[model samples]
Target: MKVKVNRHAAKALKKMLEEAGAEGKLFRVYVTSVHGDHAHYDLKLDTPTENDEVVKSDKEIDFILDKNDEYLDDIWIQFFHVPNEEWLITNPSKGGHHHHH
Candidate 1:
């Protein structure tokens, strides 16, 4: 899976990586029940030794999917501040935070 990281996201992620002295880890993207209907994702520093495929981005690292995550095909990750200091993961087709009924 490919994950795009903007300047803010890259800087933030780099800080965490530098602190741990770990590099070349993929930016894992997946769906969890946290958001319901595969809306939630946990993007953190994952080591290559732990995963099979690791994608290194110009600005960030992206993890290769074990299997195709069709829902994540167009997924984009960005960092936000005014809305609050957090990573904003979005699915252009699904919209935001609305639980599936």
Candidate 2:
């Protein structure tokens, strides 16, 4: 499993982790739904379970992913603030279709 976080996302995620209640928790990227060749993903604060793999991003933030889900592998987490603040999660290995959150 691999996770990549863009510079903007890394900064935003760092702020999220600094929130008062986020202590001891890491970001978890899970499958919300699958659409044949692609899938939707969402993020949450969570700890690693036995079935989860903690993948470290370029920013040194850890992300929890399900070990058995191919859709969870090679995920790219990005954040943009130009048009509006939002999260864009995509799997380049899957098809590179952006899933917004």
Candidate 3:
């Protein structure tokens, strides 16, 4: 499994992880819904579980993904500040559509 985080998202996530009560938790990217070809993804602060795979991004942040989920692999997590502040999670290997969070 592989996870990619943009610089902006890395900074934002790092800030989030530094918040109160986020000590030992890592970011978890989960599938919220699955449409025919693609899936929707959401993030949360969580710990690794038996069924999870902890993938480290180039930004040095670790993400938890389901080991058996095909849609969870090769995910790209991005953040934008221009038009609006939002989180965009996409999987190019799947369908490459953006899901806002």
Candidate 1 has its poorest 10 consecutive residues by lDDT at 92-101
> 1 or 2, which is superior by lDDT?
2
Sorted on TM-score, best first, the list reads: 3, 2, 1
- TM-score, predicted candidate 2 vs. hidden true structure: 0.97
In model 2, the Cα lDDT at residue 48 comes to 91
Residue 19 lDDT, candidate 2, scale 0-100 = 99
What would the C-alpha RMSD of candidate 3 be, to one decimal place? 0.6
List, residue by residue over 1-101, the lDDT tens digit for candidate 3.
99999999999999999999999999999999999999999999999989999999989999999999999999999999989999999999998976899
lDDT of the structure predicted as candidate 2: 0.93
Candidate 2, 31-78: lDDT as tens digits: 999988999999999999999999998789999999999999999999
**Model 3 Cα shift for residue 46 (angstroms):** 0.6
Q: Model 2: runs farther than 4 Å from truth? A: none
State residue 99's C-alpha deviation in candidate 2, in Å.
1.5
TM-score of 3: 0.98
Alpha-carbon TM-score of each model against the true structure: 0.63, 0.97, 0.98
Question: Which candidate wins on TM-score?
Answer: 3
